[model samples]
Target chain A: MPAICFIFLPIKYYYVRTHDEGVAVNKLNKFPKMLTRMRDGFLLNIGFAVLSIAIFLVIWYGLSIFLDTAYLPTPVEVWDALVDSFNTPDPSLGVTMWDSIMASLKRFVIGFVLALAIAVPIGLIMGFSKFAGMIGKPIVEVFRPIPPIAWVPFLFVVTGMIWGPILAIFIGVLFPVLSNVIFGVKSVEPQLIDAARTQGASKSDLFAKVVFPYTIPYMMTGIRIGLGIGWMCIVAAEMIGARGGGVGIYILTQANIGRYDYMFAGMVVIAALGLLTVEAASYVERRVSKWMGA
Target chain B: MNRSVLITIIVAVLLIGAGGAYVLLSSDDDGENKTYDVRVGYLAGDLHQVARVVASDDDVNGGESLFKENGLNISTPFAAGYANGGSVMDAFAADDIDIGFLGSPPAILKSLNLKIDIIIVAMVNSEGSSVVVKDGIDNFTDLKGKTIATPGVSSIQHLFLLELAAANGMNVKLDGTDGDDDTVFYVQVAPKDMQAAMDTNQVQAAIAWEPYGSQMILSGAGELLLWSGDVWPDHPCCVIAVSRSFAETNPDTVEMFLKAFIQANEMIDGAFDAGSGETYDRIITLATEFSGTNETVVLSSMEHMDLDYQIGDNFETYLEDYTQSYIDLGLIPGSKLADRDYANVTEYVEDLVQVQYLEAVD
Candidate 1:
């Protein structure tokens, strides 16, 4: 676990040390040295990631052998199932793994983006305007704690199958992002607001220059948390009957038919996909933070 | 933030916490579990497994449930029943039940897949399920490029649809979210949700066990395309499966359970023959209550379903054919027979379906 976290360790240092010399000749002369540092860091990250996964696989293999049951399939068995999924229609789901992933990915991305668009602005308004808070807080609080899976039947009935799973993801992601952004806006320093006001800034200017930038980090935190929750929602959401095959359905179908190896293979794809999304969010955060010099 | 208000809030929170815990624990009652000598599981709202409801009812057997008359205590852990055969098999694997009534395909699928030590003790019913389609969709080819709902791949309904699609030489697969490619796609929906799925146009057709099919027809949601019986006469649908270890440990108890089950089948047969009399009305009422459908749907369902416990040579052949179909569809690998120390599908089926307890009865 710690080895995998090391991947992010060199990222900040690599960027923080880059000198912006405003087109100076010395910056050009030092480019090769910087490239060497980047290459070293990249290799270290890759090495640590490989080591972490290797340790995980060893532990899993040992446990499977120790248990000696068909329930816990070996990594080799899972790997074969995973490879077969791409080439053939899944034994249970009747679609290639690639097809499943694409369908699920489409739902996830659509749901995630929708959550961000709707939630962030509402959170900002509710936090900033007391009247808005009076109205919005009650509604948000009422719906926030309801589990996303509980809405499977209703969503399917109302939104139909194609949009049902997507809405489930939307609901799962919405609350966390909304709550965090609200907290972020409210946590903005009063002193900073006063300074902006004294500097003859308009309401819009004050928000864009100070409030928005300060809230970025907190909003990102909410997004990271929301994305994790969103992935957890996929299984239950898609279980409502995704219009297309999905990892959640694949896992369920395999388990239903007593194909543990294939079930495990579905789980692996979901875990890998989840990790990729989280990493992508982090990378975006890193770049945004650097550009803003936060 | 007043001191008295704070105390009141804290006390209220504790009260709610205690209430929630009590509800949770009471729902999964150990006392009730201990009271039953044999715990049974069955599919929810499935009209095919009426023998179980019939066997457990006191009204039919002189004010005592048939199990009590046979000197055994039988109870269902889930009052509402499982949603499908797959879930029933899950309950057995989890040791939540000693016996289960579910589709034979799932009994075969999960037993070999998880290596769950269970034996097929008896057949529950033969042909009760139906393939229902929206109006104007008359045949197999018309079903192409449309969404159809199934309980899940673990269901015999799914197997039926697969076979139908193959016979027509048309392609069928899980819903790819894009179904314009001249391939019929199926989606997994609980049988209870079949009507809702159809209403939303998410599925143009759904294959489900009666009285769900009959219920939909009565409700005017869809029309029946084919009764399961129309396709395969005297087919094996749901069966009674017992945990092998449980049966071995309590052979007499298992026989007692089967005895009551066989008696229940006889009672059902008599009720069907009674022809609008009191016994027939009683059976309809019991089935309606058990399956949460109207008496109309139950009566309609009875006409299509054949309640039988026979696992004879013909039935054995049908089970073999079902196993072969699964292998051909890549649902179950041929290697699993060897994995379980069976030489082939025939051996696997023979080992799986044990009629010893049924024979021991009476």
Candidate 2:
């Protein structure tokens, strides 16, 4: 899915920005050569994506045929399972893929929002003030390397099932965003700050216009990395005890019952969702970078 | 250009590829793959499977395990122990273990669905599970509109929960999304964590295999609502299974393993009097260590459970009923029986179980 995303999302996102939003690229109809050249490059990328996906499918099918074990289902079988998951409830899990995704997505969004709420402010302060950084650095370093899954048993008991999984995602997403925000603050351009001050800008005005705008792109980068880790944490956490249905729970149930095809289907859903989120972050990063004239 | 050399290379590649494919597709070895130990797998920290632990004891067996005593190599595979029966089945799916002790439902559910050809050789234990409810949960009806914990859909204890709910005339559902006020919803929580889950109010009740029920009761966290025997008397829980290829290739080894297992079961049975003799004290200590619980909990657990190795006439019939329950819950597809090429559940059970190992023990 990530490999295909390297091809597919560029075209999809480009179309969404140019055609749907009627953005500046559409207004540059006068620059047909540049636009046409951009389109051609994108078309080549899409072609490569299709070719690679086809090759991957062929190899998968051939391996399934050659190995001839129930462990590896053909790609077509996986696709069918994936399609069927959306339309019907899994016999073992008794939840459709849509239901599972919604529950996971709710946890992810809530967790992401919570991370942003706490991490951003802390990161800004730590980066801006030496004393704050001194106090926070030791705690961050101590907790950073401990895996999210190590906390599953403790979290489930303390926070209960619903919030336990959410907190896992929060833990996964917090550090990257926090660290990146710190890096972004520390790396803010001295020239930009100097220019803002020379223009008679107040401290608040300089921070809002110069420091914050520069950090948006970095925050988006952290968010992209955090999103991937969040998915992984949620899946691992849910495998133990997820009260309401989740994609991880769905996959685990299928695996427990020896339904490899259904398990692969759940996995494919996660891959696709993870790719969609990263691509969305990439899109936001692009827009923010352009707005900041990067 | 170089036709002869090219042909030779092609033949060599063909030979190597075919050899690799055969190795991968083949189910068992020729009794020559014994670099490690016997690679026995069991559910981690489960007291119901203490039979294996007893068999593995060097002290009891006088400087070697029972398997070693019977002239068979016994080794604990580093990755062999699993948290649950479903994981033991997964290890079987990967062809990682020669023998495993897991729930019969997973043994039935996975072997048929995943096409893993493991045959159940003997019974491990039965009636070793109970439903523990938090304070104020007096009866089954009090469980309405609440979330309960079980191992998972494929576990025998989960089926016990469903059957007990139905026997009391309550509606039960998995996924818990559209459940009404009278419906009981279930979540998957490992037995080791059930006491914590109940203590935190994460789950109102939990149905788990013993030492957990006994552990929860002894901890003063929950009260026992139903023993598995109360639902279905002496129903099968966990059973000993062997990979078909392993059994077929290493028949003598398999026979020795069973002999050692039977000896362990006999020893365990003799120790059932609890602290009356040295054997009883040893079993209590072993049970406490193997289950990661207290001596009090182990003694309490032993009272509520039976450790039987024999599979009599009624077991196969109960297996069919268990399969039907899985089918009814949509956990197992009705067509899976046909997929396995069995005419019905009866044929499936007959093929699934092989009593020859147990019968040939003497």
What's the alpha carbon RMSD for model 1? 9.9
The window of 10 residues in a row where model 2 chain B has the poorest summed lDDT is B27-36
Model 1, A68-142: lDDT tens per residue? 877899999999999998899776676789988988899999999999999999998898889999999999999
Candidate 1 DockQ vs. native: 0.53
CAPRI-style grade of the A/B interface in model 2: medium
> Per-model i-RMS in Å?
1.5, 1.7
Residue A132 of model 1, lDDT score: 97
Query: Cα lDDT for residue A233, model 2?
Result: 91
Label model 1 with its docking quality class.
medium
- Screening candidate 2 with a backbone cut-off below 3 angstroms (N, C-alpha, C), the clashing residue pairs are none
lDDT of 1 by residue, B1-362 (tens): 99999999999999999999999877635543433389999888888888888889888887998988877678779988997777888898788999999999998888877788899998888988899999999997889988889999988999999888878887777776554556789999988889988877779999998888888888888988999888888899999999999988988888888889899999889877767777677888888888888877888888888888888667888899889888887888878778899999899888888988888874
What is the per-residue lDDT of model 2 for residues B216-297, given as tens digits with 9 covering 90 to 100? 8889779988898987888888899999888888877777888888898888887774446776777778888888898889
lDDT of the candidates, in the order given: 0.85, 0.84
